[model samples]
Target: MLSNLIRQGIKPTPLIVCAGGTSSRCAADGLWTVDLRARHRQLIINEEREEVEVGTGLTMAEVLQGLQPRGRSIPVGLSTIPGCGFVLTGGIGPLTRSQGLALDHIVGLCGVWGNGNIFDLSAPTNPASPGTASKNETHQQWKGLLGAAPFLAVVTAIRLRTQKLTPLVIWRSVCSVQQLEIAIEAAETWEHSASLQWAWNDNIELFITCCADDPAAMEAMQSLRTHLGYCPESSMAIVAGQHAQPAFGTMARAADPQERIHSEVISRLGPAWGQRLPSLMADLKELMNNRPHAGCQISAQQLGGASAQIPVSRTSFIHRNAIWKPWINATWMACDAKGQESALAWLMRANNLLSDYCPGVHLAQIHPHLSCHHQELNDAFKNWLPGLKHLKSHLDPYGLLPPL
Candidate 1:
């Protein structure tokens, strides 16, 4: 298929291979799109090893459902979107604080590059592997494709190491700006069993999840209550269930699928941003006072446990020191041109205001269509770009995929 396109002298949108079709990286003029959803839809589970080989087209929810009965789970995104693009770009999720990014669990990959050459990347000792390359050679290729596969290849399948399934205790609370700031500070120093996700949409809502009922979880909850001034009888409810139950389901229902919404996302990494939350919240409140749409929101996720312990050089993901992932997003109706412009303008201002606090960006929320895309990419990859660019040049000389 790629050879035919190349022979015909055609270059389509770089998003041709995206399984979720969620990125804004595609050409605005609507170039040809290559859909791979129909081709790769299989899931092969290795129960003994707690590993699953999945088609790139599969969503995180689907994978979770498949693994639920087997008492296994993989670190996945908060949304039930396609898993391939998520892992390829350094997947961040609710369990990131404990399990680390999803990319860290990848054991193997199979794909075709722009040159129409098929390659299987893994540890090389597995006999079922198709690549005959030496161990060192395969390892080099593995490092390159770990987080930058979108820029070099069209991945068809991935084998990921899964973890033992465990139930999670979730606590939700609504707090003021000051209370949220206090909670953010508390979450930064939380243990591996606890993680946090909070959102601000006029009101602040925090979701704290713990994998166990240990003393660490109890202390974390106590600290939150003390900081937020909430007592046991003060509407602070703790719900317990499987991690898969509320993690993605709540997010899935947040928006109406039938509505056509135009949105922009800006992600930033701040290692010590929690310390400046009070000032940041003040600035955000002022900027959001005249928001273009009611659906506009800001969210921050704590990320400093196992996710931060990993060295930056181990994978193409470079934001190892970051303790927080904060993003500002705004949405407007498709026909509301004025609303869209206003929302985008406000988002740009908000991003610029918070830029000094954050030094890196997440690829999952990156939009190449934005004017600051180049700068964002530079911030996200930092010193890692040179190696990634070399790999792209060697494997995709024609620039079949979008340049990062």
Candidate 2:
């Protein structure tokens, strides 16, 4: 099909590919739409390699459900609705501190680049595998695909390593910003088996989760929880593979059918930004007061642990030291131009606030809105754009997919 377009000296209109979810995608008007869900919904688990190969169409929910029977799970974002794009980008979840980002599990992929060339690439899982790739070109392509596949190719399938499923002990509370700051400080020093996440609406709702996979980690979780004080509102026990995170479900939800939401995700390396947390929260609280819409939200997920062990050169996710992933999500009623402008302006201001902490942007989703698109890309891909573009020139010279 792609060949026919090239043969006719034609190209798909600038397009959006729906791998499974629409939470972060923009409008489809005047653009070609490629929906992969209907035809690509297969899931297969290979016990020998302890991996599962998923069709790009599957949502994280479906993948987890499938893994449940096998007693295995993969680290993914907060909610399951993100679809495969979640992994193609860096999938940061509460378990990331212990398990690493979703992209880190990708062992192989099958894809077609922008220029209609098909290829299969794999990353070695152990020393016996080819890390010192006998074929240097293939090695480079493998690294490029793990985090930046959406920009460089149409990935049809992915093979991801899975972990033994475990139960998570979670607690929730509504706390003062100062308490939240203190919790953040303690979390930074906590064991990787635990993670802290919070979102602010009318109040600051705090959530801290620890995987009860081992005795030592459980001890650390208790120490941190005690230090953070009491939580009047706690949660029921949850087996990690049995359900999606109930706390940050909003992050994965789209607006009403008649509404639209836009998000600007930002990340900053930690150990350096720790001291400024108190002031940052205060600034954010002030900013939220003037929001044009009540639906806007500010949320953050802690990063570090196993994620920091990988070097920046390994994947397109260059913020190897990032210990905080915070985002400003702005939404408006459908067709409300004035409201849209206000919300976007508010997001820009929020980004500006984050920039002060030596921020690195995550191109979490495409920004078809030209005004912020180019600038955000520059920030997100600093020092890596030229190398990515060189690959694009060879693989997608026709600009068949998204451009940097």
Candidate 3:
């Protein structure tokens, strides 16, 4: 791949940095990439609540399913699929309101630096050697590696705090923006807010989805319902009305009533609305009734749960503070240039809206509009820039890792 790029007179891009290719089909056009699993070999969950150590390869779903049996789980995105790319970009999910993005819970990480040196970093205390050294010494050691980005390394593993696995309750429905705005406004104003939330406008291809769990989920839902003020006719008469059918992949799953309606709606992905954005609630209803798109589906997740406690000073993830993260997806019958271009254009618009309030996004999913240079991007991390740069200098002087 490197030789091909050089032969083509193109500069060498980073290796193993592309994500799962869900963000855009064009991502598959790139060469040399790795998923979370290929990068790390093992996953270790401590006997007690000590901590969970994960290889970069594990997806959010894998992490949850692995640890849930042990009464422990880490906050991951709703799209529990695996990839180090999201965490590197910014991990947001149902845990954002509570646990925050996956990156926030990360206490330590192991990865190969640009110079090919492997390094392990964590908060001052070393769990593997708890009794070997004084707390002071361990803390001093951990403090030496904060604010570092993958610019110096390809992350292989991560250690993070964990919590008990609780039953999840999902409430969803398809409605127009008008019906949804009431809920959206309530959710936006809630004391703690949602764990995950997202919306799709007219120009975008997908309808929005949001999720909120934990104790506050019930309360948030109630608040949203109250603000939405659903009436009997209005509720039952939403877009697609009662005749909506579920999309292909979603038909087999057991979902809440709202999800059933949402599944029916978001499947529609044509250029129907023109320039006028659909009312949040109305759009959802239309999606259920219309099944608009021939090749795409749109959705969003409400983030809450364990995601709120963590701050933004950790790794490269920066959406730890948003109310929700939105995703625009396109699935076509074939992978071709035309299909790829259509998906990319729609995704670009959706991502542009998503990045409005949430700036930092997964680099793998980055759209050209969101592109930024080194210095401007560095300033986004504030005081942490100096430390990350220092780590890059020490671990990857050649800057082989992908540029953030």
Best candidate according to lDDT: 2
TM-score ranking, high to low: 2, 1, 3
**For each candidate, C-alpha RMSD in Å?**
4.1, 3.3, 9.7
Residue 5 in model 2: lDDT = 49
The lDDT values for all models are 0.73, 0.73, 0.46
lDDT of 1 at 1: 62
Model 2 clash number: 0
For 1-404, candidate 2 gives per-residue lDDT tens digits of 64444334434545567886554563356666567787778899999999999999999989999998888989877777778998988888888888899898998898677777777788844422455545655766776787778778878889999998888877666777777787777777776577888877666767767786666666766776677677676453555652655746332223333445444444433333567877887898798788777777777887788888887777888887888887777767777779878888887887788777646777677775547777766676778878888888887787767776
Task: State how far residue 56 of model 1 sits from its true place (Å).
Answer: 0.5
lDDT of 1 by residue, 47-165 (tens): 88779998887777777788888888887766665557878888877778878888989888988876667887774444344554565556556777877777778888899999888
TM-score of each: 0.88, 0.90, 0.63
**lDDT of model 1, residue 343:** 88
**Count of residue pairs whose backbone atoms collide, per candidate:** 0, 0, 56
Q: Which of the predicted structures, 1 or 2, would earn the higher TM-score when compared with the native?
A: 2
What TM value does model 1 have? 0.88
Candidate 2 regions exceeding 4 Å error are 1-12, 124-134, 240-244, 249-272
- Candidate 2's C-alpha lDDT? 0.73
TM-score of 2: 0.90
